[model samples]
Structures are given as C-alpha cells and as structure tokens.
Target: MAVLNEEQEMLRDMAREWAVNESPVTEFRKVRASGEPEAFNRDAYATMAQMGWAGIIVPEAHGGSDFGYMSAGLVFEELGKTLTASPLLATTIAASAIALGGSEEQKARWLPKLASGEAIATLAVDEGAAHDPAAIETSVSGGKISGKKTFVHEAHGADLFVVAAKDGLYLVENGAGVTLTTRKLTDQRSHADVTFDGAAADKLAGGGDSLLDDVLDRARVLTAAEMLGMAQQVFDVTLEYLKQRVQFNQVLASFQALQHRMADLFADLAQMRSAVEAGLQAVDSGFGVARAATIAKAEANRVLHTISNQGIQLHGGIGMTDEYDVGFYLKRARVLEASWGSSSFLKDRYASLGGY
Candidate 1:
C-alpha cells in the first residue's frame, strides 16, 4: 500500500469534505436538470479556483500550488466521487504540455492564467476513431489552423484551445474561427465538436515526432487516476447498498454469491490502484511512461467497467433508475472508458510497446 504523507492526506481530506458538502449528489442532480453539456456548478468552480485546486499541478511561478502528480491525483480522486464536472483534468494536462514543451514566453503567458482558473484550456488531438497521434489530420499554415476536433471536453466554455495540428502544436484563441457544436454526452460534461476554419494560432513548440505521444501518455495516466477514484466510489456505494438492501429475509451482503463477487471486485480495485500508482511514479522516474500509461489506462478501463456494471447489478433495479446515483457512475465510466483511448486501443499500444 502506498502511503500518503501528512500534507497529502490533509489535501485529500479537504477535497473530500468540500466535494461532499458543496458539490454533493444533489448538485449533480440539479445540473442534470439544467440541460448543459458542462454540468459543473459555477459557484462551486469559483470556490475551487479560490482554493487553488485548479492550479494544484502548476508551478508556483504561475500562481499554482506547485504540487506534483501524486498530490493532484489525490484531489482528482475526491472530485471523481462526485463526478463533478470541471476543467481541472484538461487544465492540468495542458499545463504539462506547456511545462514540458512550451517556450519560456508561452509558459510565462499562459501558465498564470491556467493556474488562476482565468482560462480554461483543452487538448484537441483526436480527429476520429483510432487514438493514433499520427492520425492527426488537422493542418496549420500561415499562422492559421483548420480542422475539426470531435469529442472535445469542456470546450463549450474553454477560453483557449491547445490544438495538435499536423504542422505543429498550436494554441488558438477561442472564437478565432473556432465554432463549437455542443454534444450531449452520457456524462453531461461540456463536450463539443470544435471546428477551426483558418483560425489564427500561435505556435507553442515543434520538431519532435513524440510530442503528441508524450501529451497523450500524460493524459492516459491522469485519466486513469480519475477512473481509479470513480471505481473506489462505486465500490463504497455498492457495499453500503448491499448492507442495507434486504432480500430473501436478509441483507444482500449476507448472500454468499454476492460476497464472492464483492471479493473479486476488491481484488480488481487493488490491482487498479497498483497500476495507477506505478504509472504516476513512472512519469517522474524516467521509465517508459508511454507503455506504463497504456497499461494503467487499459487496466483502469477494464476494472472500472466491471465495477460500474457490478455496482448496478448489486443495486438491483434501483441502480438502473434515474433516482439512484449509481447509474451516473455507470454513464461516466462508459464515457471515460471511451475517452483518451478505448481499452482495446490501449492494450494494443501496450502490446506494441512490448514488441508483440
């Protein structure tokens, strides 16, 4: 078991308390009623910004807490329990891009805003199908980017877009030929089909074939961390439901078959945690982060998918009903599984890295 330090534990507790008190399931219910792609509570987001949660992974020079990936992952876990819709993941991933590849001036300009939550940015990489960075069909020419990015998360409200075009990675200002067609996804977060028609953009960095690879690898690891949190919550909720849900003149927890199922799920969760932690450590350890990230993501997808379905199954019909919150977990699990890359896609990547 990986132990968190006192400060890390405090941060996790703080995030858990805030998410439970402020952005509870009721808040999510309200957001669902609002018919918005990004279902986050605006006031809650502002509170998080004030608390510096948005900049947890950013450097101190950029108005951030300068916390590392492990610390940021702790906060993400708490946020996952609520399935709170925010741009934290997108912002953190984008910040890494700047930190790793951006010019000094670019970092000085964007990191502060990103860290301050004054700007929302998302990585635009997927053209369509197959999560191949090489399939990036978007083009850049004459300081302009033109292409369509599908399934862009939180893009409906993003102030900036870090686009991966064929010419290079470009940062295009919002509304500079950026047309957003919002998509209503199962998770109800703000996702859109973004079209850039000769959008003026500033080049961030270029010259490396592995730039997109590195970015996507970071995305996979971070996303796996989020999925781990979601799976943990699902397990907790299901366990509680089993204890209270009476059937056959006894609680469901008393059933031997269900007990065995829960045991299996516990093992799966433990394995997932190991995978995620390994990937997190790999990010800074100079290990093959690309391969580690793929394994982490694929394992997370499989475990979370199983956990979500089993949670619903264990909850009986109530799990399928809108009144129950487990359905939301299932929906979010499906979306997260498909995003970044599917389980099969990541598995293939992992095998290829192994020279299979």
Candidate 2:
C-alpha cells in the first residue's frame, strides 16, 4: 500500500466508511434488482460531493481545494473495493480535461458546477468496436458535432459530455439532437452508445487534438487505482476463505500449493500497488505521465485478471454462483480490464513509446 499523509489517509478512510456503510456491494445488488433509473444512487453521490470528493483535483478558485490527483486516487481506491457505482471517476476526468486544457472562460463556466456535483459529466471517445481514439469518426462543422461515440460511461444520467472528435474535444449538453443509448455492462452499470446529430456544441476553448490523450491517460490512472483496490479485495476474501474452507480434513490455506499461489499473488499485488502509485504521482507532477499511466494500467489489468481468476478457482464451486460476492468482483474486473484501454492495447502503446 502507498504511504499516505494525514489528509490522504482521512480521505481514504472516509471513502472506505461510505463504501461499507452507505454504498456496499449489497446496495449495488439491490440497485440492480430494483432496476434503478440511474446508473448510481443520486442521493449518495450528492453526499460525496458535499464531502469534496468530486472536486478533489480541481483548483480551489473553481470551487475545489486543489488537493490534486493523488488525493482523488486515494478516494477512488477505496470506492473500487465495493464497486461503488458513482460518477466520481467519470466526473473527475471530465473536470480535469477542462483544467488541463480549457481556457479560463471554459473553466469558470464548468468547473464550479462539476466541483459541486451539480453536473454529471462523462467522456465519449470510442467510436468503434476497438478503444481507439485515432479511429474517431466524429466531425465538428459549423459549431455542431455529428457522430456516434460508444463505451460512454455514466451517459445514462450525464448532464454534460466532453466528446472527442477528429478535430478536438467538444462540449455537448444533454438535450435534443444528443441521444444517449444506454448499454448495460456485465457489472449492471450504465455504459452508452451515444449519437449526436447536428447537436450544437462548443469546441473546448483551448483543448485540441492532444487533449484526448491527456484525458485518457488520467482516466487510465484513476481506473488502475480502482483495479488495485478490487485486486486487494479479491486477495483478502480468497485468503480468508482458504483459511476456513476444509478439504481432506485440512484447511485449504494449510496446503503448500495454495500458499505458494497466494504468495505469488501477494507479490503481484505489491507490483500493482507500486505501479498505480507511481502513475498517480507522475500525473500529479506532470512528468512521464503517459508512460507511467500506460504501465500502471497494463500491470493492473494483468494482476487483476490473475487474482480474480485465482479467487474463483480457490473458492471452488461457490465462486461461480451469484450468491457469492467474490463473483461480483470478478465480473467488474473483466469490465474494467477492457475499459479505457485493454491490456494488449496498452502494452502495444507502451512499446511504441520505446518501452521494452
């Protein structure tokens, strides 16, 4: 685990409490059963905003504390443990696009609302089956954007969208001509296939072609934090199960083979933790951010896949059932593995950047 200062520790603890008490996996299961209209609980998200989680990385002048991305990562890591379904991740990334490249006027207009959680925001980057920003077919002409963007997280209830086009990023509000088609994922959360037809959009004041890469890099880092948390949860739960589950008149944990597998998982988890922390620090300090983010996301994808599968295998038949919460983490882990960028895709990107 990364060493956190007092404030970061407080943020993590508070998020942990909220995830346990207010938005546990059971809460998410209930939402899934109830077929809730929104992707996440609105009331709970408002409370998060009140706690300043949504604006953790925004500048104080824009209704934020300027706490930085590391603080945001700390909170997100906790939220990931329970698979808390809120717009916090998407919102933070959207807000950051503005902070990273938006002109002062754009920041003034959008930052405060985003910081307060008064606005729910998301990004629309993927245009095809693959998560390729370079494949963006979206076009901007005459101050109107027309294209289809898929894999749009939180689009079911997003108030704002920062859309990537061939030219640059554009702001498209939720209204006529901007249609959101929700595509349910394995995790029972809302992803979207959004189509914009002659929708009036404002080109992000200063955001250009490069802004997409910047935002995606930040999103990758935040998502890696979540994956790390999930990996930890799976490891902990599986380890506990091994201790209690008995076979051949001996606890599964007592088996030498199982212990060795767990030890390997522990080492992988440590590497994941280090990668994610380095990515956070790199983004926070604006140095080697792209390399750090790709490495983190790639390692997280690999580690999470190994751990989640191991968790299922070690838990025996019960791991495959819906009654088991461990299975839930596995489903979410699969979704997150392919999110933003897949493991293979990220590795290719890293290699292209001269990484061996």
User: Which candidate's lDDT is highest?
Assistant: 2
For each candidate in turn, the TM-score is 0.96, 0.97
Off by over 4 Å in 1: none
Task: List pairs with backbone clashes in candidate 2.
Answer: none
lDDT scores of the candidates, listed in order:
0.85, 0.90
Lowest lDDT 10-residue stretch of candidate 1: 204-213
What value does the lDDT take at residue 232 in candidate 1?
95
Deviation from native of the Cα of residue 51 in model 1, angstroms? 1.7
Q: Per-residue lDDT of 1-356 in model 2, one digit per residue for the tens?
A: 56789988888888899888988889888778877646688888999999999889999999998998889998888889998888899999999888987888889999999999899898889988778877988998998899999878889879999999888888889897898777878888878899999998877757555688989999999999999889999999999999999999999999999999999999999999999999999998999999999999999999999999999999999999999999989888988898889998998899988846
RMSD of each: 1.4, 1.3
Score residue 114 of candidate 2 by CA lDDT.
92
* The 10-residue segment with the lowest total lDDT in model 2: 202-211
Using alpha carbons, what is the TM-score of model 1? 0.96
Per-residue lDDT tens digits for candidate 1, residues 131-186, read 66668789988888899998888896688888998866888889859998888888
